[model samples]
Target chain A: MTTLATRRQAAPGGSTTSRPARSGASSVGRPGFAWALPATIFFALFALVPLAAVAVLSFTSWSGLGDPEFVGFENWETLIADPVMLKSLWLSLLFIVLGVVTQTPLSILLGVWAAGNQRNRAILSAIYFIPLLLSSAAISVLWRALLDPNFGIPGQLSWLFGDGNLLGTQSGAIGVLIFVGMWQFTPFHTLIYQGAAKGIPTVLYQAAAIDGAGTMRQFFAITLPQLRNTAITSIILMVVGGLTTFETVLILTNGGPGTDTTITAFYMYQEAFQSFDFGVGSAIALVLVVVATLISLVVVKVSGYDKMNSSLEGL
Target chain B: MKTRPNYAAGIGSFVWLLIVAIPLYVMISGTFQTREEFGDNGPLSFPSSFTLQNYADAITSGFGRYFLNTVVVTVGVVAIVLLLVPPLSYAIVRSRSRGASFVFRFFLLGLAIPAQAVIVPVFYLINAVGLYDNLLGIILPTAAFALPICTLILSGTMRDITGELYEAMAMDGASPARAFFRLVLPLSKGGISTIAVFSALQAWNGFLFPLILTQSESTRVVTLGLFNFQTQYGINIPGLLAAVTLSMVPVLLVYLFARRALVQGLMGAGGK
Candidate 1:
């Protein structure tokens, strides 16, 4: 291995370091920092710069008019004492938990089921993927119309939904949000699990069947364990997606029934855009960034995703 | 190849199919009915007669303009991503400098930064630069947010180009730029198409950036237009459903024609 490495390294133009080149194979071309400069600057200007500004702006008071005044933790202090802010955090947690809990299993089942090559499964999977074609805004709007107390499906099936006022109460509103979320996102995650399930080695399943395992037993012993990585990926997406959910709450509930569904993302939009309270909004935005970052960090650490960077050694 | 049917799994999936299909049936069927008929029949009822009036009403009520704006945004975003991400990905995969890896890590960290988290400052920055209420404002940030995932996918593809290929090109005395054009571009076609589809969908379906940055009807994207249509014509269920149906037509067309590429692109978003 070392000889092969040295031979590759000794090739002319292969070395980016200052070390003297050894005589051997012809030099190989390699890209330099110049190639990466454009995207780096662009990303810094749009994403990273604004990220820093969110932190700085969180310490000041601004309402989208006049100059911002430095207030030294004032926004943070206010948010610490604010009940809506606290409750919004709790609601955000609830959204994440519900999203993962509902989406993970359902998508896994649908995915594994669809992985079969049967003609019916193929047709049904295609239909299942249709929801993914619509925008979040469109899905929310469609659901809002479809859930109207007087005109929607609930009205038609009043026996199943008494009063048919699904989005008018706290629990009712949250349920609608979760149900809509599941409807919109399950297809995409199911696609993920489908891909993962398709990749599972067939030999493992054959061996399980030879052991006289039943369908449920083979699924529990083989399919569930094999889907672990895909589950983590899907769950992380759900968490991040749930944390930043804005469109559904905006169009469907509008944080209504008295802030019942005002998750942190929606509250930030309300404070910054509607109320023009940019400072407090920035404070909320910073909290969102911190929490998202922490969660991502923990997952990366636990999953050893960072160590996957060793693939770069081949360069 | 044959075994007993899995009744439990089959039953569960059939129930989920009902859950998925009923809403879609309502939305499509509702769009074909008149407003009074729709309201009287409720969302679940079959359409008594087919009418194009709801779709016509949706088009006349600024959806045409919104469609144009969304198309522009999608094209602009795809163009920018195509120009920027491939070269960046090439560098991350082939460059040996520590700075190159650092740049890669920077974007990796960016994968965790949700657009909503920095949206307030983005709004402020767009206003400061006089790009507020402009489509360009929406294009730049939307493309920027897309870079991280695109970079990851493209680099993963580019990395699969073996070291021997580079050496073969080097033996011909090709420069890095020459090697990139000749070697990287052709091989990474799959990755390029994936990113194009992914970014185009992002721009097409984008709601938050346009919602915060641009306000006027002239600049409204389809998603925001759907939003405003809902608020302005809250009681017009048929028209609203028609608008929702219209917004998905382009994607549905793509799904029909390019289903494999679209599905591969979306699954790439899972970072495999």
Candidate 2:
């Protein structure tokens, strides 16, 4: 503990003293790397270490029993040929696209609407936030009961949903998943946009009003453009979230009627836990990581999120 | 404000509200009806009879145990996050060391690593460490995964503490730890509570960790319990719906009490 204190003291002191020509007071009470070490090591042990292990495990065969035996590319080769694996990747992409397409405009409108300080808007926003309270597992279970072909809403509204095999057919199952995803997540994205909308300079809106821009014209001209960064952040979240969605599928359809909704993440869980094909699961997991990483990199590049470091530079 | 109301947005949000409310209405209303009544009346119908039997059955069928276990995990996760993230975020915001910045970037990259992608190895590692089927197994990994986002949120909060505050603390000859305790901690209450609520929700709502890491009835969390409850009581829709409602009660209570903080905390997830 003495060494820790001195090192903490000396590091900042040394840096400040070396920069004697400049003001050093701000650095005097600054923390040291020791403060970050514990969480870094803990996060690495659990997240990063296993992340690396997953990549290696993808090249080996194991079943949660014995030591993983190296099989060098066989898992990859088989995954390449597996139709379900290929289809699952497509399903994951489709989910992302559909989630973005459906959620973005709806949330943007709702968020802007909710950003109003009016009493009714506040009450409605609170009610809208209800779905966000339930866990994905609970929401899935709730939807399953609500969409039960025999006695659910679909049954009562048979004119709209004949025979109500929503979970039986491929398109119907996908529709349920997308609709549920929107129901569960739009409020969250709406919250993000609401916060961003609140941040958009009121002066801009006033100026737009002065220019005789109607609400529609002002929203198109001011609100959407100002929300660009938030849109990127929200979309990236949706992408990553869509890629890793598992519990909803598990509880709702169990990758359904015949792996029709088996996105890669769910497929990986099934392969690893259900089928006990750890190697195959790891391979699918690696694909998920690579896909997520690629998407993140693209977003960072496009949105300059990494460049947000500039804000921390002097501090 | 506009002089006139916007009917398009008004109607759109109202429509969306119906979409959001119907399932919630169904779930909540369904729990009050008997099985025969529900089957006869259909999900959309108002219940002819209201009974607390579904909730009683849910509790009697081990939801209490699941609730206790979930509380344990949520508390464990929130504790770990509170203990670790503040200091890490503090270092990231205040430390000048290269290692600190590198660690910050490391966690920034960690934001991309989803828990599902690493579950296979995590399972192996947990089993190897004899934490499988244990609550700690769920707690450790869940807290670990929460670190990236929590660090991001707290660090963002910490950075908002202007340089003048630190310089003033330095003028008082305060040590780093003293400054952290006296100034940074007090100033960062918003971030701290946000992370606490965020991690607690993650742990409370966690399904994959508990589903994969723990198998026994003794370690069952609410989400896993509800999942299993569904399969075991598939035909008993009211009981299943009641279980789902039971799982949401704690979060709903928190929501009622602290809606603003909860909403802000969730918005923090978007890095706002």
Candidate 3:
């Protein structure tokens, strides 16, 4: 119920005594005060309040019903020695490393190759997007079957290489999850690159060709540079996503065979949901928020969020 | 790379296609035959003994309920998105003078705070609200989770609609509300559809919300129901794949026609 009329009237310069007639500006096009009220209330109650609830709850302790017992730094103290939580954190880091390092480069190559040709792009697009379209359950089930070295396609391929059930080993399972992450996440990055690559005027490439630039030269000079904002954002999302991956790993291994595949996000969920440790769970989740926030800030910096939009408009 | 995609490129595309398609083909192929046949024929072979019985078995075994439930949830979520996001975007763009930036940023917070971040609290909140077992529970949260992203996209797109359009409409004796309805509404159909399709897919594809929020068959969406199905009939690969394929049909049809807008929305929201 904050009065926007006075504020709108202020508008960086104006004055105290306002015109009642100009108060309409505060309403904008909304029908009446009563009309926009529910919506304003909904956004605050659902989004702002719940978000505030998380920020506040991160510092307190309550298990669904009780008056939350005030716990000082006990939750933070627990994560200091929590091995499982630590392992999950490490595992999450490992997943992010493999995904960003390997998956991104492979996708860049795939996109470069795919964009160069028009034939079957639709089919390839469908293929990549198929995994994306799938519900997470289906992705896990499909990959689970596919990774059945004796029975799955990848398993069959590994048979040729002699290591059949890669899902059995700790490193091997992590590898498989990374592979799945890449398979699913690549299409996302590829789409970005595909769009950006297409946006590069053909004239630039033609001019490069006449100037004796080869494919590699053209890619380095034009494609990579033009994809600057996208590449930065793409990597940002990959790191954040890789860190948060849950359903796939949860379904695939359940951090399994012995704590092999656990990301920070999934690990915290297990602690909160399965172990019922709301205190430590909240702490761990807060840590994740901090980590994710740092990562996003990096993205905004590297991509220069302020300029990316304006540059796109210029293009 | 510079050529007009010749036969060699066609061959390369096939290689990549095989990498992508073989697994999907196997998943479909696996659905038609029994586990033993799946074993003997291998995943690639055309089902030597094709049968619709697996599909029939899957359909009879709660698949119909699951499909109905999925439809209800998707329709509910899409309805919520269409109703909420456009207005929210409209408000954010038009109300620039009155703490509108903060209002916009408040929603933008949901962008980074993935729905997963609030799962525990949401579960608590939903249960407390007594929508715990109802389909409406999932619909509300899914809609909530989607609104921020959808609103963000629409807000950006709405901001881009040349102000001249609104000005011209107003000069024609149209009120601000009429200009918004007549000019802004029609122009934003593409962006809004993008939000609709995007939110629909997210709701459809979501596993986490349904898995944690709902507890029984009466309200189970396809993701959770399918997961439970796999657990009970782990050995019935054919039945499982049949169930998965059934779940895929509706979304697949929409995706085929609207891949462009859908992809654009994804890249836009997902890029950050």
Candidate 4:
């Protein structure tokens, strides 16, 4: 990489670097490194420093106002013994599972069905895309009203839904949380899959058709195979989104109906801000980060993320 | 390519659309009704009388203040992101050095670290820096969190610019900054616009930063304010929904106009 940079510097025709490669130009005047400094500094001050602080803070018994006591794994021990933490962690995982199970297949189906971008499909796609346009807070607010027992949509449609209220029951609230997530994001995955589907050369499917394969066969044989990489990408996105999602759940139920909807992030917020237990909060935060990183790394390795772009060569 | 109706797909699409649309209708329509109408007629019912009273109530009751705070933070964050990301992404994509790659990787690491993980320290950090209760507290961290993805998208877009364009600018004796403004900036409009809208949306909708970093009513952004507003005015559902609808306007308008770019950008970002 260093050689590439020096060689590129020697190539007088290329001016990609922020510093022009002019004859007799001083090496100290290269602006490429300087140009990137602001973003790097901003990132260091905010992301890197805060990350390290959190890691360090997790090991200490510190409130926001005083000197931290180096407790050393006591927070982690407390976390293990805490039932609420365990429950919140389990619920967070369940929410992610529910999201992946429901959203991935549904998005692929929707993507395949809408891939052609027909006129009517375009109109329907616009309608389907509406949810993606709104803020999660707005959606949570809207759903909160709609889930109201007396006057909202679910209540109005009680004849069909059996008078059950969402936000009030443990199981129902979790279900609705997952449902809302799928509702808001399925369009996103569908759009990604649609773009991927379009990238597949039509000739493959057409040739299959000429060989007397029906639409179903052509789909399984041609479309599904081609969609594999995109499907993996979609799963990575879906899982990460599902696991990290807290805003809608936060606003919709605030992890209420007795903490049924409280994911780890929500629990962390409650601990740190509401309860002012920064040590436990920081520990939860580290745990969440570690778990999320492990899960995402596994997903990436399984999906062959490095090979995804290259595999599109067949298209 | 005949315009033949595929009834199954059409019906499926329509069903999904309805699932997505009904709540939106409920929210907007619910905002237009009086609390009496809302309670009496059920939220799904069309309003018998359209009223601006809810809007009046929302604006009068702290929603307006929160809206302005949100606008300030969103504008500040977006402006910083756009100014910094373009040049940084340009540098990363242009300079093929080990140091540049390390910087790029460092930025990407931000994506994995959830804001929740850093919120503990971030809260204290803001307090330590004396930015607690300041909008800058929210702006700095929010912009920082937004950098990784924005840089990723911008660098991807920048790398796609043909090498010939850079060569031509070099031959013209244009300095790198001059070429960036004269050649790269003009050519990277799509990517720039994408990240601009992306960053703006993030800042507008961000809940965690404003919730954690800022404490005073003066520093509150809309999302946090909306939560508090709902709790305080829990009984006045219409007024709450009205505030919700009002907050949706700015972003809704942005989405309507930039739907194409937004969709392309999101897909492009995710596809990578």
lDDT of 1 by residue, A1-315 (tens): 455566666756656552345222333477888999999999999999999999999999999977778999999999999999999999999999998889888999999999988999999999999999999999999999999898899999999999999998999999999999999999999998898899999998888889888788888999998887777778788899999999999999999889999999999999999999999999999999999988877876897656755532311
Clashing residue pairs found in predicted model 2: none
TM-score of each: 0.95, 0.94, 0.88, 0.91
What's candidate 4's i-RMS value? 4.1
- Better-scoring candidate (DockQ), 1 or 4: 1
Q: List the candidate numbers ranked by TM-score, top first.
A: 1, 2, 4, 3
Question: How good is the docking of model 4, as DockQ?
Answer: 0.53
Could you give candidate 2's per-residue lDDT for residues A176-294 as a string of tens digits? 99999999999999988898899898999898899899988998999999887788888888999999998889988889879899999999999999999999999999999999999
**Top-TM-score structure, candidate number:** 1
Q: How far is candidate 2 from the true structure (C-alpha RMSD, Å)?
A: 4.5
Alpha carbon lDDT of residue A219, candidate 1?
88
Interface RMSD of each: 3.0, 3.4, 4.8, 4.1
Off by over 4 Å in 1: A1-28, A301-315
Model 4 lDDT tens row, B1-272: 22345677667777877788777787889888999999889887888999999999988888888988999998999999998999898788776456777888787777787777888888888888899989999999999998988888888778788865675566566777887888778989988888888888888888888878878888878888778886777778898889888888886686778777767645545755
lDDT measured at residue B40 in model 2 versus the true structure, 0 to 100: 93
B250 in model 1: Cα distance from truth in Å? 0.4
Candidate 2 has a DockQ of: 0.62
lDDT of each: 0.90, 0.89, 0.72, 0.80
